[model samples]
Target: MATMSSICAPMISVLPRRPMIVAAFQQYCSRRTFRRTLQVRSCSSATSHVAPLRRLANYHPNIWTDEHVQSLTSTSKVQREEERERINVLKEQTRNLIREKQQVAEQLQLIDHLQQLGVAYHFKDEIADVLSRLHASLDHVRWELKDDLHATALLFRLLRAKGFSVSQDLFETFRDEKGNFEARCENPIRGLLSLYEASYYEKEGESVLKEAMDFATEQLKALMEEGSVPEAGGLREQVAHALQIPLNWRLERVHHRWFIEACSGDNTIDPLLLEFAKHDFNLVQDMYKSELKELSKWWSELGLSEKLPFFRDRLFENYLWAVGFTYEPDNWRCRLNETKAICFITLIDDIYDVYGTLDELQIFTDVVNRWDLTAMDKLPEYMRLCFFALFNFVHDEGYRVMKEKGLDIVPDLKRTWGDLWTADFEEAKWFHHDQTPKLEEYLENAWVSISGPTILVNAYCMGKDLTGEALKSFPSYYQITRFSSRLFRLIDDMGTSTDELERGDVAKCIQCYMHEKGVSEEVARSEIRELIKKHWRALNASLSWDSPFQEYFKNIVVNVPRTAYFFYQDGDGYGKPDGETKSQIISIVFEPIQI
Candidate 1:
């Protein structure tokens, strides 16, 4: 042992290089004997006059020269130092590899677990659980590793790709760590579905999508405890209680599809019909103010003086009726206008053609013609609505076409017309009968043709003029009207027989009409088809009348097939529906008319 604190400590000390040599000398031989016995030791001792070995038998040198000792000491220190350094390097390398392997293993485990979960993780319930687990893990990591970015993001991708269950706030709070989010979303199945789903939600997931949803029940509970969340106050329950709405496939699908089809084709239904339907269907909530303003401006610019006088009031009434007819049932304007139009049309049609004598008609006509709107004070209350409608609608461009068709060719035609119009109530009623044997039957048949493919054209105009909540889509209207018309026509046509019609059957006119159209005898009725084509042309022209109902009317005429009119049953005198007929009609016709 050595005390190196000594100031006089030897600068260099040498010891035997070999452990075996040093041990052998110490155990076996004395230094004097060893020196005398060894040839080199003997020679060196003689020359140096080797100090007489003290106690030769037990002689032991305090100082000795041995190259091995010095070499051994130097090698031992160097070897120990090298060994220490190697052990340290190995431990450091192993620790680093362990960390790397742990990360890879964790990711693999996650992937395998997710694969087992399958795509169900992308939906709601399962997705929420996955997100909860993921968020919990993150929370642990945030505490354990102080929010490692690479670690957190991989978990985020897993959660997002599978489905989101976390609040947008939580997701956004970690967005800085989500470097290149779009680039990370490379999974094809995940990408397609995610994009489609995102289209229904907000573009920026930060506020609504990610932050809005709670990641965990605990998190939700926390918010409630803090009073940060608002109460819904049973609003949804109230809404459900107030309404028992049913689904209408016709309104939702068939009518919309058919309307678009008709509008796209080379038919009289105005092309704008589909546009109108779309506006009412989708944009009504947002675009109401602008639409009303434009409609009013158009009305003010066009006055009643430009329209044909005879059909002028009728056109105006129709316009007002349109405004009322196309809005939701709860709308005040709609209700008001509906009441006014219904009474006005019912009374005016009767007064003009059926209800009044020629003298009365003349006086009424003179009253409307000679005076301004103020003079309507002398007429019945219903007349006021009629006069206003006429005054306003005549100002529309629709009447110009009828005038140009040489309809007003005769001079002093009113004077001649008053005489001609005298006492024709019976004839007019007969003409009405000639047109349709029964009122219900007539309305049903007309409604079918009007609603089917025809609504698309008319929807455009209706959408343009109406305001407030969208009552019903043009497509829905067409569907309802078509189904109604077809159901009635089918029952009416099938009930009648050719034999019955030949027997001077005035009762089952539906059958008579079918026979007149030669529907039964001929497999493919060419003449009937030609008549339909002509009717369609007329209907198209009628729809183009440039009135407010122009678009609505156009669709009615265009979408409905003429053949559908023949669907009614034909009976000898009058027809009745079969037992199953009502149910079948209700199922097919009425089921699809919901909003």
Candidate 2:
């Protein structure tokens, strides 16, 4: 929304408000609770059995059935060769969509469309060439800054999203002498939408971009509710969608499929681009189907859902999480590997949190920490199958990572698993003892319990060259991953805490805040939301670290949290995908655009 052109000696003078208290409060909590918490934690480490475990039915049985597995495994879906050839032709046509001499605004809009279509990866060089030239000669660009709010905002959002250092000065052109945005203009609603999208890339301390967000959100929300125009209904839908998830937060494939439908019936949209988008989308869907065929077959063979009735059967959701981790076709192995890893994490988490009793949990934890099948005798009959499943999976993964990749990250991977178990065990201990930790105290361990770092370690190992240096140099990656884990914990707490509390879990961050500050649920939730944003900035800042690995490698870590936010933003979208997330999964992975 904002761009740089010239300096504003005293540009919009910003009124300074009270500094945010959340960050300060978090630091204060951490400091104040440090010594006492350690003392409490020391006592907590010594276990004392209090009461017999209740047969808790806190969660419902998983909806999956053997028949469901049978049907998924039996399905033989394949895209015909004819479709591949057709898509190749359409890709060529789409390539022609980005030519050398297009107007700068048009080029930016085209790039934006291609990106949202999930086919931008196919045209990276073409898009990059256009943006590079445009960036080098912005002054000589053909588009005038005065008349085109939509184009300006779109260009700003796209370029800034691509890591360009565009400034906020150009946005000032839309403001009056009193430094207020002009809300009345041609296509003001669409302009405001793009401006809102652009504001997400605001770096820390950029008050202008922050102000732009408040301005655009205020304008868009008012416009949506007022029903001011003949096409107010369409405007309402567009506004609602934009305000619900900022463009940066959206998964590319998910947004792409949605856009394919949104652009339908719009005469101005390029026919070639639209056709190519459909072809590419379904083509990728075919790839996902093919991959899932193998994964589903493997999952069906495990018979996990039938054996471990308590564990949620989410074969599809696990794979979907991997897709979020890395969606490029060449990264299928990483996706598959990460999918299996997360599957175990999810099930094991369920075991510690819900199903397994205190004695059973300690035995299983020790068995897992040792990765020893000999200890399986100590587990309950049901847990033996679960333990063996993970044992065999880890051994197989270890062999692949070592023999296939010629690097021994097995130990590191197991260490991540160890960290996860320690965290999970700690929480299980607190839960069993009916302990309510201080906000800082719970957060210290809860982030790990979220298991993002463990899942991401598998992702990193799968996707990267497993060098000795890379294996040992994991702390930096783990640091970035901690940010993700914290976000996932916060989001999970936001979505599932009430149910969790009812089921006799330890106090989540929100509950701890409510207890500590004596605040209402609403206020506690608002504070948690602010804290989530704080970690979001931390995640963004982590990407700027001097990493031994490439930026893409780091991005996979960052995307861990991005995908979590996408998954858990509204509710426990991953665990309960009945509403927005369900539709999104259908659009991205199953339904094809009707070309």
Candidate 3:
């Protein structure tokens, strides 16, 4: 007990400052009362030590030092005020950034409105003046100031729409410091050009469009070599280059007759075959010339003469598709005339039986059956050696492939010749005029009746295991037809034969399905996007197919999968209506595997 009293003596004993100390203790107790409400573990831990003190002191509240409390309160107020000022500064900065963005958005909306007005009222002199001013203002904007390349490209397009050629000027002005401008604009100008070129080259000769292609290619290469540009933009260069050159150009350049003519030696005329060659060349040339005349007529019929330049390319593409295989029965004269002496009659039957007029068909058939290769001089201006060369190529190649497969081909050839002649002669009564179908209807029929199914089948054969039932059921003739059809169809679709829709006509099957499901275009488009992505995923997930045919399929499917943005028009023309948003619907067709 004595030892315990000694231990407590320091804590309890009175001293000179005993009253002051006691007052301090009472004040500390009052502070503890307020702090105890906090429920801190430390407060609970200290409660045990304070129990005896409460019993002993029973102290009254004592005033705290004015100096200490005033100093602490003033210091806290200063700190809080400083914090508030800091918050206000941050908020002001955010507000400024938002204002900047909104201003930019407003500017974009204004630009779009101005463009719509320009296109709608282009012919009106007053509106033209307004459009001109807008163009001047927009043209004055430095390319480096554009935060988005897509936006800049669109602006350039708008300027072009306002009747100014911005292609060369756009490159000169906006070649540097684009920042995210490239990201935003997406190089829409180049894209438009590429699509246009790709669509155009399908029908027209490459040489005819080479100048324009070179210009576009140069612009694309500049974007790529700029190095500072994003890889995304740079990646488009190859596509631009590819679109510039159609497969026909590559094929024909290396092996086709047009290329052979261009590269022919010394322009030396072969006396024996010169007239024949010139005659055949003229026939082929005349055919193309006739196609161009037909195109002009088609344009006039549609009242699309003003839009002709826009479709001038696609029209040429249609020509390419039409004429690609049309005159294959004859080609440019070759040096080895003897080796090229095979008869030309592969496509004559198809033209007479399927595509030609009765009178024209009769003329063709009679020429085929009765005409003599030895009597080249007696033939018309169109039936000379050039035609002979092309004919020889078809017959010779056909004979070789057939003979290698162990078939008696001579009698088959003679029978085909007779069939062509018979059809051509008999159809003369029906050859009143060339049949012309509605452009869209003709293309749709072509897709369903020939190209679409054929290409799809080709894609299947390239990927699927073609053993057992598939191998047996698929005939040699069907295989040949399907293969030739795909090649022709691809060429045709690529803008050579016909102008296939850019985004692909989903056919009623797809549109009806979407409508029946009661889904909005937005939802349907989303689903399509997901479906396409899923297809690509599955395609990538599979073992990489390495064969030549597989590679070909991959190229078509991955690189040039058909879409139909070109020929489709709603109530509004090609694009969206005023202040209305539109989404694209993409449907993918796949073959189901059988168990």
Candidate 4:
């Protein structure tokens, strides 16, 4: 039997050509006469006589303090019990409703509502049964929905979303002899909205869905411009919201409260279903508060905020990220461990990006790669503390997994940590040497540097059961990881590159593209947006691929980019959270829905 270490050694070697390219770039950079202008003071003892010049981001203090987070309380135990009982009853009623709905359209709408309200996990089996039946009888479904554009689009979206093999050819029924979506499909706002949302589920090379997207978008915008959409029932608001960010891309937990509020204004919504959604949301929110309180205590005790004051203290944001990845009450362990990993990633990211001199960063990277206590003495005091904090967290997690599942994942954890630091160190070298690689070269390293692999790998270790076979099959999963990380890096660059450049960081993907193509910044941004869409299509296609990973881990992979899109949609939401991010956090984490 192959050892886990031997089976997983290749996971750390993403983009093997990257090192040679980086070396050549460094060789070229070292020969440039202009290098002296870019060099900064080193933080080594040899330069102890000179005060080291450090770049400070001056990030705002955390809006949600540890004291406030620790002070949070949920409902009393008795009330929580009562609510749980009521929710169970509601679940039964919802189940019966699913069973009773003989019509395919009704079943699809019910499942869509349940998902939108963020309570679909309760009825996964029921929803799957319906989709399976509908998928099994595609001919009957096609006949039933032939004239009904709205139901057909809803069916296609829901079925495809569940990884069912639904064909885009089903949409041809609505097209005319010219192979264009008929004008009759335009006036029905409900059908148009459904088509628009469903179009986002398109895989690459699907020209029909692309046309449908363009048609629906044009009609929807035209109707809005003509003031034709009804102002009542929140339909207008729904259109605007979908236009801003489609349902397929938005984070589920973050969209839950908004959808619940939207349903309240919708007269067509069932009173019982709406009640169930509210209670479920509050109960889930209660669970999150408890988790946050405990995590807050953990963060407070970790004392990294005081020890490394230069980094952003973003415990609340990190918790939001964990919840975005996995919001089920049963998966609290995954959420907690994920938050801890992200906190350390953020702290270490700051060390490379903002504070650490190149020499100090290289030393820290070497220490992390060695994964040894003896190597810690070479790092600065601050780097030593950060290294130990990461070391203990990773080993502690590895210990838990080993004790529970008889799998020692310490080597896996250490490899991902080393990979992340190596990528970060490469970027630091780029910054210090004033070299701008092409966009492809930048992303080959930036994707890993973005910390998506590290976060996802930790998630896999803590959330999934490990076996020798699973470890053997792990290399295949890295493709999805790369896709997720690529999207994450691009979205992050779009949001933070301006500030990063001002603070003397390496050239991000956007800047790399502009330099490579000799295009304007506006053109570069537009191109990056196109790349985001392209990667999303690739990711959507990858979800249906057969792999050793269960849907639980796969969903986390997809949600990584979805969460990034949410935070960076407006502007550096995680780094500067005082704007819309603050209100969003309050709604999702703190404020309970009024039942």
The TM-score between candidate 4 and the true structure equals 0.92
Per-residue CA lDDT of candidate 2, range 345-393, in tens?
9888888877666667788777877888887889778889987887788
- In terms of lDDT, the poorest run of 10 residues in model 3 is 584-593
State the lDDT of candidate 4 residue by residue for 419-509, as single tens digits: 8888888877777765677788788888888988888888887765557667656566777888898999999999987666656566788
TM value for model 1: 0.23
Q: Estimate each model's TM-score.
A: 0.23, 0.83, 0.23, 0.92
Model 3 scores a TM of 0.23
The candidate with the higher lDDT, 1 or 2, is 2
- List lDDT for all candidates, in order: 0.31, 0.69, 0.31, 0.82
| Local accuracy of candidate 3 as per-residue lDDT tens digits, 1-595 | 0111121112111112222223323343344343334224333545665311111111111122223222321124464465446545543443343235333323433343222211111123433443355456654564443544434444443444333433333433333453111222444554434333332221123232233335555655565566533334323433444454432123221122322232233122222222223233333343334334444354334332132121111232223322322222222111011111111221232333233333334454455555456655544333343235444644664465344544333333333334334533332222222122222322223322333222333233322232333323333233233223333323332331111111111122122223334444345445544433333323222223434333333333322122211212122111221211111100000111110
What's the CA error at residue 10 for candidate 1, in Å?
Answer: 99
Name the candidate that leads on TM-score: 4
Ranking by TM-score: 4, 2, 3, 1
Residue-level lDDT tens digits of model 1 in 210-248: 322222223334444575443243222212221221111
Residue 451 of model 4, lDDT score: 89
Name the 10 consecutive residues with the lowest summed lDDT in model 1.
1-10
Overlapping backbone residue pairs in candidate 3 total: 43
Q: Check candidate 4 and list the clashing pairs.
A: none
